[model samples]
Target: MDCGPGDEGDGSSPVTTPTRTSSTPGRPSPPAEPSTAGRSSAAGRPFIAGQSSTAGRPFTEGQSSTAGRPSAPARLLASPAGVHAHARIAARADPHGRTVLPVLDGEGPLALRRTRATGPAAHVTLVGAMSGPLGGDSLAIDADVGAGARLSVGSAAATIALPGQDGAAARYDVRLTVADGAELRWLPEQLISVRGSALRVTTRADVAEGGRLVLREEQVLGRTGEEPGLLHSRLTVRYAGRTLLDQELTCGPGAPAGWDGPAVLAGHRAVGQLVVVRPEFAYESPESAVLGESAALTPLAGPAALITALAPDALRLRHILDDALSRLM
Candidate 1:
């Protein structure tokens, strides 16, 4: 909750919390011996990254690629392309059993770090070393879910979009791929579009047959007691070579946003949405359904639903989102 500039809240704990797990190759968990100091224990658990069915037994020390030394934390990067942060996680089926294994875990700014394991799911949180998306800033996340893997992911704090040093617009792009029979739940924190700031979130996901995906997106046009800024968002989802969702929203032209006029936000300060795609999803989404005046649930094509919550302040908006989620959760 106390997310500072360039720093994130402690999401590694609550110890049972949000985000999700990931994987990649590492030194196998070594046998107890003087030669294998600092080796992580594989005897604890084998999570595919998100949440897997109970069919496969968990992986043991004798069957792990990352049982040895742990992966390093993410670093900050800045280049001509812009200040960019990258995190990649890939999961695979363990040859030893029905369990899934993590083969890669990496990140830059808005770094993704895994905490402890819980059941068939791996916990992960995104932490930042500094304030970002200062116009032209790009954050790209790539996740791959093997044929039977599962993963959950979230951010430790809200993304504070600030004006760029050279007045360029900020960008955050996410790319997710869920293979056959895989699952991924991506629920990051709200994004704060501050006054004079320009921010955008471009997300693209590809889900293979029999896969499932749950994703949440929240945005705040302005912090408490401040004017709104500019926000642009895009979402694209496809499965089995069929496009399920393709949409975009733009608020204001540039720096000083037009929150009062005829924008979709309707002078509101906040908005939130959730999307779910499962193998069993067959209901036709309706155009829109109001939720007690605090929110509206829109059924999109396929097995996806979008909830939009609008309020004069952040608190009310969040409460509305929570109420809407409780029904679906």
Candidate 2:
């Protein structure tokens, strides 16, 4: 599949046809193959500003923000205090069941923009108003979907984590809440960890019994040929007050031994995970199976499914995740 620096792939490739291992007694049929054409090849494409951290950089003064957006104030961008930013989104349903955003608040480097939607679901795009998540930075995003509402969240570009003057690790937190009868899709771009940077990210989802969710996360250990710095990530999800999935990953210089060995990343640069939660999954869940060579799909204890994959590059990683999502949904 072709995923240009600017395009995130949304189609499938036949090479990733899953190899099933087991099935449950009462499970729905797997999703049919998506008929969309495969994307073009992303090989040898140069990294743009948002797709990478070191774009056009010599760490000199007067550098511009990615995508022509205005950079943050000089004091904030260069301050030794680091950045503290938060963005919040609250979506509710109208009497006629149309989704609406009553609260869209963004601060510091995290900017939220409402975009035109193709359906009833309210869509939001996260814009990186400034270069960030540098070491010592603290950022968080909170989203709430009320009952019967549908919301889809995406980012304008990939996030690049860079080194900071303080030598402290950057922190990012995501909190998502899905009310009963509501649906949410959190599909952001990849996060690239640059050399000399340290970053830690956590994502938690609280889903009501009848709520539905589809979340995707992708991490690129380092830009093209560079060595990664330090990265740690954790994900937790609860459905109806019960744990559905909880996992953690660490990589780079300070990670546990052999993290890049065969059993783990196996030298892959891009790693990703996808989770889908639906009430119907309680009655019918996908069977444990291997999708392609680098990805796996398994049914969770509740009405959820998980997909984990690794790839040589962000393009391929998104292909594997997108294929798994198509199969699950």
Q: Assess every candidate by TM-score.
A: 0.70, 0.77
Query: CA lDDT, every prediction?
Result: 0.59, 0.73
Off by over 4 Å in 1: 1-81, 95-104, 253-263, 283-289
What lDDT does model 1 reach? 0.59
**lDDT string, candidate 2, 1-329, tens digits:** 01212122113221221111121112122222223122211231111112212221211111111223433333345544566666778888878778777676655556565654677788776755455577788999999999999999987668888887658999999999999999999999999999998999999999999999999999998899999989999999999999999999999998999999998999999999999999998788889999888889999989999999999999999999988888887
Q: Which run of 10 residues does model 2 get worst, by summed lDDT? A: 17-26
Quote the positional error of residue 236 for candidate 1 in Å.
1.4
RMSD of 2: 14.1
| Model 2 error, position 271 (Å) | 0.6
Q: Root-mean-square deviation of each candidate, in angstroms?
A: 12.6, 14.1
Q: Which candidate leads the pack in TM-score? A: 2
